[model samples]
Structure formats: C-alpha cells, structure tokens
Target chain A: MKMTHKRRDMLVGLSFIAIWIVGFAALTLYPLIKTFIFSFQDVDITVEGIVTTNIKFENYRALFKFDLNFMDLIRMFVEEIFIYVPIIIVFAMMIAVILNQKIRFKGVFRSIFFLPVIIVSGPVVAELFSQGATTLPLIEQYGILDIVTNTFPESISEPLEKMFSEIIFILWMSGVQILIFLAGLQKIDSSIYEAAAIDGASPWEMFWKITLPSLGNLISINILYSVVTLSSFATNDVLRKIRIDMFSPDEGYGYASAEAVIYLIVILLILGLFGVIYLILRKRSVRMS
Target chain B: MITTWHKIKHKLIGRTITEGILYKVFIYLLLTSIGYIFLFPLLFMLSNSLKDIDDLLSPMVIWIPSKIYLTNFQLAFQTLDYFRTFFVGLSVTLLPAVLQTFIASLIGYGFAKFKFPFKNVLLGLVLLTYIIPPQITMISKYVLFTDLGLTNSAWSIIIPASFGQGLNSALFIFIFYQFFRMLPKTLDDAARIDGANRYYIFFKIAIPLSVPAYVTSLLFAFVWYFNETYIAAIFLGGQVPTLQLNLVSFAQSYTALAAANQHFFSINEGVKNASTILAILPMLIMYFVLQKSFVEGIDKTGFAGGE
Candidate 1:
C-alpha cells in the first residue's frame, strides 16, 4: 500500500511537469529545432510546409561572408546596443536610485514606476511610431539616423521616424528593472549603511564599495531580462527585417529564413558574450567572498 | 561676513535643521517631480485618447480639453467589442491565478511538511523557471498548441498554467513552504497522532493557517493577469477577443502603421484606455479594500525583500 501510494505521488509530479514539457516543447523546443532545419532547407513556409530533405550550412556561411549590406546589419545591431542600452541603463538606474530613496508618497511612486510592466503589446508601439514620423521627417531633412543608425542612407527619408520608434524601444522598458534594483537595495541591511556612515563613508564610496557590490546578482538578472525583452520590439533591425520578410508578398522566404537564422545566431552570440562576462564577474565575486 | 555666519549656522544647526528641511523639501519636490515625469506620458495618452479627430490632429491639446469628448470612449467600446473582451480576459486571468496559487500552496505544503526525496531538486527546477526567458519557448509552445489542435482555444492559455507558471505560484510555493516549514512540526505531528491523513491536515490545519499567503497569491494572480497579454497575443494570435485583443484590434484599426489606416486600432485605443482603467481599477480597488492585508502579504511573501 505504501509502495502504491509512493508510485501515485511520483506519477502526480511527473504528470505535472509533463504538461509544462508539452507547452515548452511545442512553443519553444520544436520551433527552435525547426528554425535551424528550415534555415538550411530551401522551403517556403506559407505554401510548402516543413520538408527538410535538402540541407546546407550556407545560411551560417553567408552571415559572416561580409558584404556591405551584411556589414550594415551587423553595424546597426551594434549601434543600437551602444546608443540604446546605455541610455536605458543610466536613465533607469537614476530613476530607480532616486525612487529607492526614503521619499514620502512611496506607494504612488511605486505604482508609477511599475506602470510600464502593464503597457506591453498594444497600439502603443504604432502610435509611438506615427508620432515619431512627424518629427523624424524633419530630422531626416537634416540627418539624425546617420548619427544613430550609423549608415544614414539618403534613401531612408524618415530619420526622425526611425529614431522615434527606436526611442519607444529605449524608453518603455524600465519598470521591472527599477523594481529589481529597488528590491536589491532593500535587501541591503540598513545597519550596513548606518555603520558605513558612522565610519565616514561617503554616498558615492558606499555605493561602489558596499551597495553596488552587494547587488551584483541583481544587476546580472536586470541586464539579462532587459536584453531578452528587447527581442520583441519591432525596431530590432534584424527582427524587423525578418518580420517584414515573413509578411512580404513575394516571399523569398528562403532568404528570409537565412536572415532570421543569421539574426538568431547573432543574438545567441550576444547572449553568450553577456553570459561569459557575467561568469567572470561572478568568479571575481567568489574570490572576493 | 554673511557667508561665514551662514557656514557657522550650517555647521551648528545644519545636521538637524538643514537636513530635515532639505529632506522634506527635496522629498516633496523631487519625488513629485519624478512622479509627474513618470505620469506625464500616460496622462498624455489618456487625454489624447479622448480628443476629437480635429483636436488629435491639432498641434497640441497640451492642457485640459475645451470639452470632454466622451465620443471616443463610445467609439472605442463599439469598435473593440470591449464588453465581450473584458469578461473573457477576467476568466482567463482568474483561472490560472487561482489554480497556480492553490497548487503552489499544496506543493509548498508538501515541501514544508513531508520529508520527500528530491525536494531540493524540485525546488531548484521551480527556481530555474524564473530565470528562463519565456520568449525562448513561445513559438514552440504555439506550435505545440497548433499540433494539439488547441490553437485559439482557452485551453492553450489555461492548461499549461494548470501545471504552473513560475510567476507567483513558484514564489508563492516557496513563501508558503517557508511559512509552513517554520510552523512547529508538532502541529502536523499532533494531527497525525489524532489520525488525520495528510489531505485532511492540509485542508483543515495547514490551509486555514495560510490565509495571508492565499491572499498574497490571489492578489498577485489578479494583478499579473489583469494586464497580461504576451501569451494571449501569441496563443490567440489576436484574432480572438480577449481584452488585449480588443485593445490591439482597436489600435490596429486606427494605426497608420499598416499601409492603410485600419481605423480599428484608433477606435480601440480610446475605449482600451477606459478598459485599461477598468481592468486595473479592480486591482487598485483590491489594494484599497485590503490595504492592510496587501501590506502584510508583501511582508509575509518577502516579494519586495530582495532581488
């Protein structure tokens, strides 16, 4: 009877996880496997379904083959990382730090900070763009995407528009990060700060030595979450192009697949690089510990 | 002479008077300023949503409208089919949230009460889900649903969650687990000695004692799902009418992003805000109604304690 009951308990847990397995497999696992398979196999997704008899590693090859357009895609991704990431981090950090301070009306400020978490996936992206289009046309008549996007083609007239869409990407996603930071800040023993002050540590020094050092774990999570979240934005040059490709009338979906695979590879590499940096930082932390 | 006198005053009374006064003034000015900064865009959107087409196109309303054009809300409602969307969204959100919370509590109870093998492994797996970005599996999950022929069905949204989302459930499980574990093992021991089975003890003693946690998980689910549309967008593909779908469809109609203006999205954004306010009002209302419980829940849950 005990054995039977043990088996029953095991089955329940197995069944519980199995449900997640199917969801994860269907939503993520299979799509991930299919992306690579479809990338190599010249197949039209909209018409001809997944047939993968033919395969070549050419998609990966062409990604780094180094044409001007290819290089431009690479450059655009980097420029975005440089321009957008810092602005988001700095502004979000500043806002979070300020909000973390002991201020009156804390609850209202907390609500205001968390507002963006609720604003995901709506007409907001488009409205933000159209609003930008008005100003971007004026900016393009001068040239700002040239500075930001790096390759300011005279062909692309709506500089302000592109920047506007990009700004929406940059500005909108800080609520969770602020919360994470606030959580991290709150975790620090108040006595540590009290003692530090009693020992003559300045705010800047304390932030670097005590506060930031302690928040290493959260900072890594914040960075990872922020980066992953940016993947959904329509403004991600690669993702944007791939989406356009998927929706295009005359679908050279093979090429589009190639672009998408290449984009995924690049994203994976970026994530990998971040992971390495985090690992190194974590090791150094361990040594310090 | 004035500067020197000021410096001396700053030195003597500054620590108390200056810091206190400065903190008060700064808190008021700085916090409120930041509050306005955070609030302006939303307020801008709310105001813009109400403007007449003529006003919408004008250089700016920049301030309160001459007349409150309630027509936008009417158009938004009609266009987005807000009534239908609201109810469906409520059910979808409520089911997962409740189920997740309950399961978390049960699982938490198990972890806390019984000495189960691989409990640590199970807990670790639970924590791992919190880190894995949901996007990684989104497309694959959609494909899975497509294969299961559950596409565009509520099951696609509901069933996976019957298992659990790592959101409140996992965290709640830990919270519940911790609280249950912290309870003197004597309670369960005494109940067992009285011939109570695990289920009876769970339902009778363990559960009744976990009201704060129940409320925490309840509110967590309510708030999280109230505005949640990420999976809804992918799973339902926005062809169906959930609240978010209503908003998206509304936004799409009005949007010029699509080659032609659909007018659908424009209509939607207007009513969507009204719905947005409505959708969230319950959460804020819940907070007000259970302000004490909400604060206590946060304390017990340790949700805000650390990263």
Candidate 2:
C-alpha cells in the first residue's frame, strides 16, 4: 500500500508537469539543438524543406572577420549593460525606499512609475524616442550633451550622451525593478529599524547597516532583470540586427544562427560575471559585519 | 533667541522615530521630482499628440495645444483601422495569456508540491530558459511553425503559449512556484487524508488559495503578450494585424493612405504621436482600472524572497 501510494505521487506529479515537459523538449530543446547545428552549416529553405551544407566555422569566421558593425554592437551592448544596470538598480532602490515611507498617495506614485511597463513596447518606445519625447527639454537647452562630449573622451562620452538623452526611458525600464525592491523593502521587519533607532543609530547608519544589507540579494536580482530587459528589448540594436540578418540573402539562416549563438554566450557570460562579482562583494560585506 | 532657534530647528528636523516637518517636506519634494521624470514621456506624448501643425512648430507652444485638435486622431484612427486591429490584438494577447498563465500554474504546482526525479535540475532549466533570449530559438521555431502551416495566424502565437513557451512564460511559472511554495504543505496532507485525490486537492484547495498569484501572473502575461511585437511581427505579421504591428508600419501606411485619398497633408509628428497613443491606450486604461492588483500583487506574491 505504501509503495503504491509513493508511485501514485510520482505519477501524479509527472502528469501535472507533462505539458511543460513536452514544451521543453519540443519548443526549447529541439530549437536550441537545431540552431546549434544550423550555425555550422549553410542553410536554405527551398520549398522542398531546409537544405544544409556543412560550412565548418565559416559563419562564425565571417561574423568576426567581415562583420565590422557586429563587434561594435556587442561592445555597446556590454557597455550599456554596465552603465545602465547600476543606474536602474540605484534609481529603483531609491524610489522603493521613498515609496515604502509613510507618505501620502503612495498608490498614485506607484501607478505613474509602473505605467511604462504596461505601454512600453518596441514600437511605442521607438516612436517616443523619434519624437524626442524621451529626453528632457532642459537637457538640450542647457547644452548638457555638448558639455559631456567636450569633457570626456569619445569612447566614454558617447554612452554618457546616449544615457543623458534616454534618461527617462532608462527610468521607465525600472518599473518592475522598483516593484521588486519595494517588495523586498516591505518584507524587512519594522522592529529592526525601531530597535536601531532606540540604540541611537541615525537613519543614514540604519540604511547602510540594515537596509542595504537586507536588500543585497534583491540588488543582484534587479541587476539580472535590468540586464535581460535592456538587452532583449525590442528596440535593442543588436536584436534588430539579428532579426534583419535572418532574412538577408547574403547572411541567411546560418550566419544569423551564429550571431544568435554568440549573443546568447555573451549574455550568459555577463550574468556569470555579475554573479561572481556579487558573491565576492557579499562575502566581504558579510565578513566586515 | 538661541534657545528658541534650537527648538524650532529640532521641531523641523526631529530625531529617530518621527520624521520632522523638514524631512517630510524633503521626501515629498524628492518623490514629486522623481515622479515627474517617470511621467515626462507620457506627458510629452499626450501634449504632442494633441497639437496641431502650428502648435507643433511654434516655439512658445510647449505644453498646451492652441486648441483641442482632432484631425490627427481622425487620420490615425483611419490608418490603424482601430477597432478591427484592437480585437485581433486582444484575441492574440488575451487567449495566449490565459492559456500561458493556466499552464504555468499547473507546472508551478507540480514543482512546489510533489517530489519528482531531477526536479531541482528541471526548475533550474526553467530559469535558464528565461535567460536565453528568444532570438536564439526564434528562427528554428519560425521554420517549424511555417512547416506546420501555423504562420500568419493566431495559432502561431497561441500554440507556443498553450505549451508554456510563451512570452516570459518562465517568469510566470516561477511566480506561481514561489506562491505555491508559500502555501502550507499541511493543507495538502489534510486533503489527502480526507480521501481527496491529488487532482482534486490541486483544483479544490491549491487553485482556490492561489488567487493573488493567478491574478498577478495573468495580468503580467497579458501585458507582455500585448506589447510583444518582435515575435508577433515575425509570426503573425502577414494576415493577423495587431495594434502594435500596425503602429510599427504607421508611417508607411499613412503615406499609402494619403496617396490613395489624394489628401495632400503630409504626415506630421502629431499624427504619428496620435497613432502611438492609440496603440498603447488599451493598456493604459487596463492599468488604471486594475491599479491595485497591478501594484500590490507583487507584495502578496512574495516574489522577491521565496528563493
């Protein structure tokens, strides 16, 4: 009876997950394997079906050697992640902290901040940017872009200018991050802060000691979320290029597949790098406290 | 006088528990300014969309339009074929979202409740799927869909979703996983002891208890699907016209319409902005109506801490 009951549990659990297992195998794993294979071959759809010719590393070679803008786009993607992720995480944290306070009309503030997540699609964002709605009029009127360009080297200044121009868009992307942080903030027991206050610890001290430490995991989560959203956003130049190249007769499926594979690898490496850096910092902070 | 000044300052900047009047003022000011940055784009969109050509061109006419101009909206509505595309968009987004949310809940429940072989590894793979951009598998999926005669149809989008491979399906599943995990195992145990089967317990107990999770997941999945232009454009670009896909081709369509009607008015920023607004208007309305669930759902789901 015990053995049959245990067997029943296993069967029931597997049955529940049956759809997902099929989806994983058919949609995700199969396509992933096909893409990997297609990356190595010259693939064409000739109505008879997909025809493949083994091209060795030619697609990858062409990407690195002949594709001038691909490398640049990849660099810009990494740079944007570095610059934008921190800004987003910090801005979100600040807002979450503010919203968690005993303030008036918290709902209204949250609604406004989170509106972007609802309406923000690639086309909508592109339209907004094209119409110059993304940047503040003050930015241009004050010649902040000119000042930044003159102040820093071109490599550093270019991203800074891009950042300043799309500052609001960056803030808009933080809607989900803010919610994540706010949730984390709400979970922190008020009693801890009250106890610290009784011990004569200042708000500033409490923020660093209690608040920041408590939110460390959430910060990493936000980092991951920010990087993924920014990279995969419909308006992202790299993704746009990948989509366009898929149909280009010269590049076709193989080259596009190679590019897609490289992009996946780059994103994974970025996440792994962030994970390591976070682990190291967390360890040091733990030791110090 | 010095004592009085100190007392005033102390009152304005209280220590510890009570935030002083000065601090309260500072907090409000900070919040309002940050809130303005968030609203700036929408405000810009609203203001610009309502402007006539003269208002758009005038340097002085920044925020206020000279008058409420309806021409841009008229042209935009005609170009978008607003109602037809909206329903099409809704069908694709709404159906997929409902299916994805339901399937995600089932998968999430399975992960949360029963001990299965390689469950931990499978869960990790689900997270891995979220990280892998859709671009990687998109081409092959497109080919597969094309082969199955699913391209240029709602099924192209709906089929993947029904199978739990929809837009950000993994995230929805994770949310469900977190929510279901938070439910006490004792509930399931008691149900079983009362001769309730596993399926019965899931439907009767687990599903009923996870309303907040279901709401949060469904709302987000719907929004994400609605705004998903990348896959939608690739899959349903031919026959199925979503509002977003319409907006993507707005300029070209406007040009075509203008040439056909011989209406010599060139497409202006106002027309473009108006169309963009139309594309996002449904989502904006939905957000406003369900503002409470949209905001507080995150808190109730215990989304951040369940790891």
Candidate 3:
C-alpha cells in the first residue's frame, strides 16, 4: 500500500525537526520549568547533585523586602525604557530615512553606522569609559560639562549628564533598528509615492499619510527589540545585581532565581505595554484609512 | 557665490537653494556627525593604545597621539597569550556557529515547507525561546550541565548548538524560515516530480538558495559567541579562557604577578586599550571583509520580527 502523501511529508518534516525538538526540550523548556521550581526553593548544587528544599515565599519576600532592591531598580529600568525606546525608534527612523535616500557612498556610511553593532560589547565600552574616553574630547575642550553643571542644579545635572551618555549608547544600539527600518522603507513600492504625488500630496503630507502608516509594524518591532535588548544587556546593573547575587556566597541559587523571575516579569510587563500600544495604534490607523 | 548657488538650486529644485544644496549639505553634515559618534569608541581605543606614558600624561594629547607606541600591544599580546587563546576561541566559536547555522536552516526549512501536526505550536514555542530572558534559564542550565559533567568544556557551548539550541537560535530559525518561505514552491515541486527525495531537495535546492540566511546566522553566531564572556564564565569557568575572557582577566593576572615580583609597575590605561583593540580586531576584520553580504544579511534578518 502506498503511503499517503501527507503522511510522507509529515514524516520527513518530523525527521528534520526531531533534533530541534529534543534540543529545545532539553535546553529551553526543561530549564525554564526547572528555573521556576528552583525559584521557590532553597537550592544548593554540590559535587554530587542539586539539593532543593521546598520553601515558602521566603525567597521572593526577601527579594522584595531586604535584598535585590527590586523597586528602585525596576522603576529606573522602566523610566529608562520609556525614555530610550521612543528616542531610539525616532532616531533610527530618521537615520534610516536619510540612509535610504539617493546619497553618494551610501555603502560607506552604512558600514560606518553599523560598525558599533559589531564592536560595542559590554567590556569594551566599560573599558573605554574607565579610561575617561566615554565622550568626545572636543566636548571637554569646549567646557560643555562646565556649562551644563552651571546651567542646572546638581540633582538635575547629574541625571542630565547620565541621560546624555545614555543617548550616545542608545544611538549605538539603533544600528540594527536602522537596518530594519531601511529594509522596510525599501519594501514600500515606489508606485505608492508616484500615485500620492499625482494626487498632489506634499512631501510632508506623504510622510504623515503614507510613510508612517506603512511603517507601523516596523516601528513596533523596533520598540520591542530595543526594550528587550536594553533590558538583557549585561551592563544593565539590575540584571547584573541579580547575576551577582546568583553567584555570591550568601544568597546562591534560589534567591537569584527569584530575582530573575521578578526581572522577567518586569520585562514582560514593559513588552506588554509597548505591544498593546502598538495594537491600539494599528487599530487607529486601520480605522482612519 | 550666492548667484551661482541660486542658479544651481533653481535648476535642481525648481525653487530655492534652501531646499536643494542646503538640504543635501545638511544631510551629509548630519550623517557625518552621527557616523563620527558611532566611530568614536574604536577611534578612542586606537589612539589611546598608541599613546606613550609621556603622551598620556600630557593633557594636550587627545584624538591623535603625539608619538605612536607599540609597547602596549606587545605587552597585551604577551599577557593574553594571543596564539593559544586564539585557537581556543576559534574552536569554541567556529564549531558551534557552523553547526547552529546548519541546524537552524534544516529546522527552518521544515517549518516553512511542511504542514505537520502542531507545526504552529512548535513555531510558537520557538518564538517563546526568544522572549524568555536567558538569565532565568542560565542557573538551572548550570546545574544541569554540571550534573552531566559538561561544565568547563568546549562541548558545553558546542553540544547545545549542534542540536539547534545555541545562542539566539530562535532568531536564526526565524531568519531561515523567512528566507526559505520566500522561495517559489515550483522549484521544490519540479525536483519532487523528478523523484528527488526530500533530503535531496533540501540539500540541492533549499540549502543552495539560502546564502543570505546562512551568512546571517553564521556571522551573527560567530560574533555573539566570541563576545559572550558571561555564559562562557558560567559554563566553561576557568578551564578554557576565550579571547574576551582572557582580555578581562589580564588585569588581575598582571596585578598578581606584579605584586608577587614586588615590582613598582602599575597597570596603565594604554595596555587596557590595546587589549580591547586586539580582542575586537578579528570581528572588525570579518565585518569589513564580508561587508556586502553582512549588510544584506542584516537587511534580510529584519523579517525575524515577523508580521
């Protein structure tokens, strides 16, 4: 009896996918479950095996009450997300539009802008900053720091300086977003623009009516990517603090897992906010058009 | 100057120089300035690496060094044991990167071409991997790896990737799926009509057409693996130091040795700069060499965001 074509295809497909199934089960799914289990327990790893003692909400309580410093860090991270995500999205969109233009040596400019993505790792940036090479020397030479200090109160000036530094870092992080937006821009059919122009659409009108609406999906993707990447970065002191506690002598595994779980929730919450906003904007655009 | 500018502008924009030459100039100016900001770190590293003790002390010395010095590079190279660690890094990175790329391609092809049971669920599971922060899973994984006696070995990195579960493997699969799904079904159908087996079709047709996906997965896998010191520290520990780890540990070792020898020498910023520069040199070179395909890969991988 001839095997059904559907069965044959399914069998072949399963064979190809079998390894990933096993791998994901072992690497991702299993570990995820185990992490959740470990979060509520007092876990100790020895030479022989893992020893898990099921406990109450003590680890989590400690996470919130005494250790982890959850509230302040989470608030700061949320604020940073709110501040940086929009800036990165807008900045990346603007740069991508410029790069997408019929400019000369576009490849050269593309490579230059993309260089940071390849080379800017945590240690490299930390190393550079340690050596007092964080900002351009020209800024120092021009007494920009002095002017800023004089202009603002100390409370405002400190965060202002930090915000300025973060802008540079966020600009660096926008490389991949720029690439994504550029690709999205290229995917828009030129005929749409030609039609708009025939209907006497100004460039400004075209951008508002056509370009922004067309790029709606990409903007959401950029926001999600930026927020997620920003949160997971090793340089993120909140995550770093959790990681440190993970390996530290007193807290060890369980406490870190609790912190990790909380941090994970925080990230998901932020992602959900952006995701919902994206959905609302998409709905509005559809209704308007 | 004004009349010539006006004439050129009128000819070009049909109105004013404000919208023509000035606009173009402003764009170039903006691009150059932002490009400089992006280039600042590398420039800072390079210039600082070449600065001597005297040049470093002189407040006047900034962007360009007064005198170029090779001593820092020489010292960092020696401390890092550049050759030994280079081979270690290559071994750890190359196998995992290549294996994950191949595995991702195969899995991605499966999802794209075949309508099997729970296909959507499986694909959703893959997306779940991307969303789940690695920190939560990392500790449990350490416990698991240690139990399996895979910790502190290159296999800790390579074995997971061999099964298509390496770093950002989900993103790789997403990219491969996007690339493979774009191919016309006629090609697969024609091959099948000729009695080509599924494996043969995948190898001969699908794999061959996926150059962009392959490059995207491979290059990114390699770079992420190379730069990954955190996971390496957790899994490999101190057994095998990849180049980045070596660069990080260089200062501690230097201080220890200097203290042991009772030397008055202090760790200078120049040497630190040199280590960073050298550590990132390979990635920099790879980016420049594969610049065209790299750009295309990045452009293509944007679809990983999905509709």
Candidate 4:
C-alpha cells in the first residue's frame, strides 16, 4: 500500500527525529519530572535500594527559613546577571564593532580575543583566580579600586569592586559574545550606512540610528548566552554548594534537588524578565523607526 | 593658513563613508589595547609558569623569569599523570563529541527540511533544552546511570550524547537546522525526481553541503566536553581521570606523589601555574590549528539570524 506524500513526509520527519524524541523523554523529560518529585520528597539511599518519603515543600521551606547562605548566593547570582550581562554585551559590541572595521591584522586580533573560550574550564579558571592572574595588577597599582570604593556607596561599590578585581576574566567571558556580535555586525548591509551617510548622518549618528537598532535581536541573544554561561559555570558557588549538599548526610538528595529547582526558577525568571524588556525595547525601536 | 588647517583636519577625520587616519589610528589603538586585555591572563600564566622560586618571590621580577624553569613542568607532568589522563580525557570528550555532533546533524536535518505535525513545538522543545540548566536533570540522570551501571565510565557521557542530549547538543541542532534550511530545496527535489529515497537524498545532498556546520559543531562540542568538569566529576565519580578532573585535584595529587617519593619540596605558585598551563595547552593548540574555521564558522552557523 502506497502512502500519501504528506504522510510519507511526516513519517520521514518522525523517523529523523525519533532518536531525539527518545532522548528527550528519557534524559530530559523523565529526569525533569523526577527532579521536581525529588524536590518534595525526603530521598534516602539504603543498602537494599533507594527510598523516598513525601515531605511536600519541607525541603523548600527549610531552604528559605534556614539557609541564609542560599539566599546570599541567590542575591549574588542575580547581582551578577545584572552586572555582568550588560557589561559583557557592551564590551562584546565594542570589540565586535572595532573588529568589523577595515583594519589590518583583524585575524590576529580576532584569534587573540577568542582564545579564552577554548581554555576557560572550571579548573583552569580556578587556578588562574587562585594565582591572581585573572585580575589586572595595574588596577591596584593605579589606585582605581580605592577611588571607586571611596566614590560609590556600599551597594554600588561592591559590584564595582568585583568588576575591577575580575575585569580581565569578565572580558574573557566576552570572547564568544564578541564573535556572535561580529557575525551580526557583518550581516548588516553597508548600503544602509551609506544611505544614512548620504542623508548627512555622522558616524556616531549612524551607530545609534542604524547599527544599534539593527542589532536589537542580537543584544537579547547575547544577554541570554552570557547569563547562561555565567550561571552554569562549573565553579559557581551555588552549584558547588548544591553538589556538596547532595552527598551530605543531613541534606541528602531532596534538599539539593530543591536548591536545583530554585536555581532553575531564578534562571527562568531572569530570562523572562530579559525577554519582556527586549520586547518592550524592540517595540519602541520599531515605533520610532 | 586657517583654511589649510581646517582642510587637514577634515582629511584626518574622514566622513562616515571613509575612515580617516585619526579614526584608523583610534580603531587600531582600541583593538590593540583590548587585545592586550584579552591576552593578559595567558601572558601572566606563561610568565609565572617560567618563574623560579626566587623570581616568583622577588619584587624586581614581574613579567620575566630570572632563569628558565623546567622543574615546574617536570613536577606538573608527574602530578597530572599526563599521558594516561590525556587519552582518558579524549575517550570521554572526543568520542561523545563525535556522537553528539553526528546525532545533532541528523536531528537538525529533520527539523530543517521536513514539514510535520508539532514541528514548531518540537523545535521549541529543542531550544528549551538549551535553556534548562543541566543541574536540574543531573540528579535523576545520576541515579538512572548508577542503576544501569554506566556511572564511572565513558558510557555515561557517550550514551546521552549519542541520543542527542549531550552538552550543548541543542545549540548544535539549531546550527545544523539553520544550515540545512539555507540549502536550496531544488537539489533535494532533483534527487527525489531521480527516484532517490528520503534518506538517500539527505545523505547525498544535505550532508555534503553542510560541512561548515559539521566542523563548527564538532569543534565546539569537543571543546565543551573537554572543558566540562562539573558533570564529568559527578557522573564519572572520579574513577575516570580526565585532564580537567586531574587538574582540580592537582594539589592533592602532588602532595601524594611527593610523599610516595619521599621528596619534600613545597608546592609553589610556579608549579601550580605550570599545571594550569599544561591542562589548557591541548585546547590552545587545537584553537590555533583550526583558527580560521573556528572564527569563520560562526558566520556559517547562522547565529545572527535567530529563530
């Protein structure tokens, strides 16, 4: 019996995606559900097998009521997303714009900028951080840290201090973002810039009116990428804590799962917040144009 | 004289269409400075790795060493168990990366070309996987893998990856989808008219055209897997020693080795720096070797045109 063309296509499509479907169910979906369940239960490992008790919201309650450190970690994570995302996006955009120009040794510059992405593992970065290689010594030598601390209030100064201390490492995180921005920058038609120029737009004016708006979608993409990379980094204190708590006799799997759930929710919230902001800005840009 | 000076200023700072000398200099200066910032840590690592005990301690010596230091490298080489761990690292990272890349290509081809029910939803699900942190599922995956006796072995990584759930697999699928979608449908249609089956058309037409996607995805997968320690540490159970895992325990390993040999030299910054350098050396070499494709492949990945 011959199948209809539409049916044939559908079957073929399903066949192609069959492995992914199975994988998603087993590896992603099942585990996701299991994690959710595990978060509410008191999970224990026994000699015979695994065991769980339904202790709904107890793990979460304990986390909020007792875990002060978890709260601090969450605050730091949110602060990092707020501080690092814009800095990375802006730095990446700046470097990408420069690299996109008609310049000599562009390849050399590009390779140098992208070097960090290749070698930035958890251990390598941890070693660098331990050895004080991640920071620029000049910042200390030049007393920029002192000035910033003195100038700003504690709330502002704290993040500023972090920014100064890990300045190079922060810049290192921009390697992939730079490449992403560069790709976006390259795709912009030069004719638009030319037309704007003909209409008496200065370079600065062209950047704001044409380049920035054209890169609106890319800005959001970069923001998402930066947030994910920063959050999921191996050496993240919160992740490290979760991993530690997983094996602790007092906490076990349930508490750790609860922490993971909270972390996931926070990440989703950040992404949602960014998505809303991006949509609002995009709408404004469209209306303005 | 005033008119001449004004003319010179205009020439030095060209209009929007053309970059003038001042602008060109400014661009180069900015690029060079930022480039320095990017290379600072690497330079610091290299310089410190070469420093001896005296040079490391001495205030006079900053960027350069007083004398060349081979002892640190020797010590680091021993501490890392360099050769054995390197291949072990390859077994987990490279093998899984290859499997992940191939599977991602097939899945991407599916999403790109085929018009099927819930296609958009499925594709959205693929991206949703990327957004979901691996930690959320890791606990359950750990339990599952432990049950299957896949823990502490490469199978734990390889199995998930082969099924298209590896590290950053969704991004690769998206990349291939972008690449395959960009290919003209006429080629596939022509092949079909000649009585080629769907699989035949895909294998012949689609795979051949998407070399850039494959290369880009493979490189990224390899690098990501190679660098991944959190998941590796959890799943591998520290029985399988990758370079990254080894590096994490470098100090302990060094102490243990020193005790075994009964040679008591305190672990110094130079030795630690050397180990760090050694850990990243392979990836750094790979990046330089594939420098062009590494940079240019970003363009081919169609990252600029997001869904």
Worst 10 residues of 2 chain B by lDDT: B14-23
Docking class of 1: incorrect
Off by over 4 Å in 1: A1-52, A58-97, A132-172, A232-268, A279-289, B1-4, B7-13, B16-28, B57-60, B100-140, B165-234, B237-239, B251-300, B304-307
- Interface RMSD (Å), each candidate? 5.4, 1.5, 2.1, 1.5
Residue-by-residue lDDT tens digits, candidate 3, B1-307: 9999878767666443224666788889999998888787778789889988888788899778887898888878877878888887776787799998999999988998888999999998987777776766888898889889899998889988888778778878888887788889999999999999999999998888877778887988898788777677778887887778887787986676568654325678888888899889889999989987777776775463465
Best by TM-score: 2
The Cα local distance difference test for each model comes to 0.59, 0.89, 0.81, 0.89
Pitting candidate 1 against candidate 3, the one with the higher DockQ is 3
Q: 1 or 4, which is superior by TM-score? A: 4
- What is the overall TM-score of model 4 with all chains considered together? 0.97
Give the winner by lDDT: 3 or 4.
4
Which lDDT value does model 2 have at B189?
A: 85
Q: What is the lDDT of residue A112 in candidate 2?
A: 87
Candidate 1 lDDT by residue in tens digits, B245-305 = 5554555553433345344334343454554444344455665566555444555654443
Question: Candidate 1, TM-score vs. the true structure?
Answer: 0.73
* After superposition, candidate 4 runs with Cα above 4 Å error: A1-3, B16-18, B262-264
Once model 2 is optimally superposed onto the true structure by TM-score, how far is the C-alpha of residue B4 displaced, in angstroms? 1.0
Task: Mark the regions of model 2 whose C-alpha exceeds 4 Å error after superposition.
Answer: B16-18, B262-264
List clashing residue pairs in candidate 3. none
- For model 2 chain A, the run of ten residues with the poorest summed lDDT: A128-137
Report the poorest 10 consecutive residues by lDDT, candidate 4 chain B: B13-22
Model 1, position A166, has a per-residue lDDT of 51
